[model samples]
Target: MKQLFVLATALLLAVSCSQNKAPKTLVLYYSQTNTTKAVAEEIANALGADLEAILPVVPYDGDMGATAARCAKDAAEGKLPELKPFTVDVAAYDVIFLGYPIWMGTYAPPVAAALEAVNLDGKKVVPFCTFGSGGLDTSVKDLQAKLPNTEILPGYGVRTARIDAAKAEVDYFLKSNGFLAGEVTPLPDFSEVRPATEADAAIFDAAVGTYPMIHAAATEVASRAVPGGIEYLFTAKDLPRDPAVEIPDHFIKVYVLAEDGKEPVFTQVLR
Candidate 1:
């Protein structure tokens, strides 16, 4: 009789503990041009999570060229911008949704400095970012390396040009990751790659032509159907800007979305 009572009490306590606790989430981000801030706010609103921005002691302002030069000088000196001290108790959060804008190829200097200041050990980290082209995968890898004990999950990234898509995309991202309650259709896999046809090349040209950084031509392509239309995965060969330079040509993977009744756009590029 005593054993039965003890077992019942233990089970009751276990049930109470399990049912009463919810993981606390915080949306922490640093935005240069407010693009990342928009994403951070959307996430916080959706999750009802705490929101905070990581600010640098010296704000990165001025023209793009000037900012780039300053960043470069800092990088060459191995210097990280001093971050303004965080007001929130970072240790209290169970899950941190870390967001940033990609600078050169990873999280901007302020984020790098924030990582140095905050100890995120044993916490679950979800990465999100805005970029000119693409850098989420690389930044996530960097975070994993820096915080070996932290659980880094799959991340969401959007191009600066596609900031307008963040709302619908963030909703889908949260739902798909089980962070929010909703149903999302799983995206289909791309079909096997084949040589690009004239139409495929035309679509690729129209998508990448505006980007000053890309001077490549599509060689092969594969595609799958998305919700609104189709998504293409193009294997492109970089065209030499200077024939006399004698640099070896390499391949890059580009993702382009052809939505219904709209011009196709390159969603992300994997170099």
Candidate 2:
């Protein structure tokens, strides 16, 4: 009976330990050149999360010319490309990492399709992108507009040329966003600030009109100085805008200025 009691206690301890383990994650990525796909796999393996591939219902051309043509047409028409069927039980995980390659200065259409098809109301979303030159291109901003009430963390982008070399950055990003099971690191506050000009306001207004969930706005109209440049104060609002100011090509860039008029505090390009 004593031996039986010892076994029961040991089993109980094991169960408790297992129950306290870090939550699992889900990695969803859409890649054309396989760079983003490779990164997604690495992150999933590192975090012990399930891997999901987001494919479009309409296939994309692997060649640059055809793909570019298709993407351009879609953008011009404001179309949300359809995605292959994907299902996720909202309660299965604590975090979802959405990965994609930057296409035409924004999130890939297939990724948008995937997000639209599924619901991510209460999940923490971490977006990672691979870009050739334009860097992150407004993926986080665009996502915030589309998905409201979701905790969409700031994204990380690696140059396509340096993708294989981005392991450290990828690890840091995952750790920073609370996706990987580890001690959480502090992040700089990234609240959206209002723009200074009517042009800026129009650009943000267009984005809000499109997504309408991020609560982005034009908060302050004044500018501040930082180390190298000026920081502009603005409110981030999520709402529709007048069609007159909705031109996509000429939206204002987002930036943070130093209070002392020394340099730019920080910056993110918004559309």
Candidate 3:
């Protein structure tokens, strides 16, 4: 009877331990315009994980041109904006979904600050970003460099214009990575995207040389018209010779606008 009682007590303890296991997943993000926040919320809901935002001590001005200028200044100085105290306990989560907006071809400064705050050693860090025209490869490499001790996964990137259509892509990303289990919603056919025309190529070619970091020679891959401007995806060669910075060899997204007979200006560049 004594031995049987001891065995039962051990079994109960094992069950209790299993039930008291800590949550292994969390979604952490910093968003300026709510684009990254929308995607992060979807991911958190799908994975049933906890959600936390990195609040900056000084919030960004909502104006795009102003924000871009500020980001450029900070990037050139290699300075990260100060972030408010993070709410999540870094030690409690084993998997971190790090999401942010791509600012000047990299993670926003607040994300840089957040990376410094957390000890992500031994954690699996998955990144996702919202960009105007930039891809995920550059930002993923940057994140890996910052969190050398963590396992960084190949991330997901969505154009800010396509956030409404991101449900299927987000679902597939989570399931393929083993973060979620279940049926994935099918994506709508985007076959209607118009191809780049000769005129579009000319416009892109004329604007590419005007930018500093962009190469003069470019091949227009795709073009689409948005509300106020035309968006061009270009494969650029011989990028600006900057040894101190890491630039990815990939398609750069450029937006051009010419209104009221004004000279067409390259409004945005996503490298």
Candidate 4:
């Protein structure tokens, strides 16, 4: 009887241990100018996960133009900067939250280096980024191509101009995605796309006109109601602008948020 009792207790303990084992998460990021670092730290804190920075052996610390030039040159030469040895055993973690700032419409070169050095096979990777305009979709595509074995989960991104909104957005994002323990009222679907009215065009212009990189004319718009205001999705044609500032894409979609009693500002641009 005593032996049977001991076996039952062992089984109970095993069940308890299995129930308590949480999936481990690590936030690995490479940040230039600290925008992406802030987002990484926020996710790490909110999730209570481990955080580590991916560093390049030769830093890109030059002025904006010089750094961009260097990045272009290195990319053209098919060179990836050497990465510092990662202290964390990546295989030990079940999930990796990869973060970086968008440069040249994709993940920074240092992050590219890190991906080459670390093998995250079969792990769930959540990408989070900070960008000047938008590169989340493009970088995620690149990541999918690079790490075909890893499960690439849907990611979160915040514009550099709207970094202040990231805290609340991240919280909502975590809860909405089932990453955190909370209830979120899911946002309603956007209204169907229709021709942009004069007023809609005005809002679109107000939102994106000041931005130097984007020279677009809104052709169609769709709106949805949010807690504080209306969110617009604009299907825009790439305006004929100076070839210097134009991107190769002909059509782009822009998301604009017009909060109550505030001016409209663009959130993200999808090309």
Candidate 5:
């Protein structure tokens, strides 16, 4: 019965190999000013996942005003900028960490193009974003709506002001989500933030009617600086809050170009 024994041993080895195969993961992202890229790198390193950046065929201008104007036009028109050739076997990866900087309450346009390029019908999608005062909940919902066939995990967001503590935040997120087995680190705290001042109100007022996306009148609540611009967080005075939602102070972020001589031309509006 030596042949029978050999066959059984081979079958057991095959089963063991199948069971022990490492889960393949990919970290795909599009970063405008390296903020999202930094977060993506941290997640990729923690999970030992392959990393890929989505590059647009035409590089955006370094001037914050110019880039903002272009992005606004493209986004309004539903035009996806042509992307540089990025080939990834999407089906091979069991998990994909999709990252982007928040643009107008949604993921960047390049992210939209990337998601449309691949068929992730059965894969797990974990979305993460970099923002000023904006939260990740809205963007995660947008992604879920776009790829309803895929499973989306709870996402993570990092404010540019808190980039120094991203590793800790990412660690906590990973451990909490059962993606890692290790000691959890404390999440970043921004509770000591000061209230918005009259200067902040003036900035919002100056750019009120500049962009189509931003409401004509708003009450400035907070503000923060991103890489290429400053985001003025505000709440519409006319809009009623949904009592069903727990977040009472939910604010929208209006991005303005950071360069001098710019009349605070509004670029992006994000919730």
Candidate 6:
């Protein structure tokens, strides 16, 4: 009886401990406009994670032109602007979701500043980006190089102005990347390939200079071939190359619209 009682007590203690353990997640974002903030909130809500805002010591002007100027200046200087004081016990979370707007075609320097402030060694860093229309613009690659110690995954990017329409896209992106689970409705037939302007053509050419695959002929570029008539390519090369903007080698991605509606039937990295 005494032995049995001890065994039962041990089992009960193990069950209680298991039930009390919580999943660790953290959502951190830097937003000048609330678009990134809203998207970040949705992710945090979905993950039930702790939320932290990366604020600069000096706030940025929301005006597009002024903001562009400021971002350009910073990027040119490679300056790490001072950030408002904040803290995260990095060891506590197993995963961290980072969100930011694509400023000057790359991540806002303030995002880099926030990253510098924290140590992400051994942590999982998942990045989500918001842009006016330029999309991720090499922010993911840049972050990977910057935070070499962290185990980072491929990230999701959304147009800041169209985030409301991107809700399903956001949900699908997070899930496909393993941040969330369950049946994911793929992205819709959302891509529309339009005529490329001279500048657009030039950007594609420039991106190839940075990413050699961009200029490769369809046969030469070896990835899952996106079938014609089923794919859409959105090209934007009017991406300004100003010092204020931290634009990296921004390129385009091609995706096939899935029949299930809003789900990408296929996806490819163009550059």
Could you tell me every candidate's TM-score relative to the true structure?
0.95, 0.58, 0.65, 0.93, 0.66, 0.65
lDDT of 4: 0.92
Whole-model alpha-carbon lDDT for candidate 3:
0.75
lDDT of each: 0.93, 0.68, 0.75, 0.92, 0.75, 0.67
The backbone clash count of each candidate, in order, is 0, 24, 0, 0, 1, 14
Compared with the true structure, what per-residue lDDT tens digits does model 6 show for residues 1-271? Answer: 9999999999999999989876589998999988889889988887778999998988996698988788778778888779878777756887888889887667888888888788888888888878754446478888889888888877877754357656776777778777678776443544344565554443334333343223321111112222222333534332444557755555455322233223332232423
Clashes of 4: 0
lDDT per residue as tens, model 3, 1-271: 9999999999999999999986489999999989999999999999889999999888996697999888888879988889888787977898889999987778988988988888899988889999876657788888878888899987887877668757877988888766777765443322243455677567666765454455644544555554344444554444546667766665555555443444554545555
lDDT of 1 at 53: 99
Candidate 5: give the clashing pairs. Answer: 105-270
lDDT of 5 at 54: 93
**Largest lDDT belongs to which candidate?**
1
The local lDDT score (0 to 100) that residue 129 gets in candidate 4 is 96
Candidate 2 per-residue lDDT, tens place, 147-262, comes to 89789878777767557557866787677765665764453444354434776565445433433223355644545443343445444443345645543432233443343433
Error of 2 at 215 (Å): 33
Across residues 10-79, which tens digit of lDDT does each residue of candidate 5 receive?
Answer: 9999999999997799999999999999999999999988999999999774566787788888878988
Candidate 5 residues lying further than 4 Å off, grouped into runs, are 1-4, 185-271
After superposing candidate 1 on the true structure, give the runs of residues whose Cα lies further than 4 Å from its correct spot. 2-7, 243-245
Which candidate model has the greater TM-score, 2 or 4? 4
**lDDT string, candidate 4, 1-271, tens digits:** 9999999999999999999999999999999799999999999999999999998888888977998999888889999888888889887999999999988899988999999888899999999999989999999999999999999999999999999999999999889988899999999999999999999999999999679888888999999999999999999988767766756658899999999999999999997
What RMSD does each model have against the real structure?
A: 1.6, 9.2, 8.7, 2.5, 9.7, 8.4
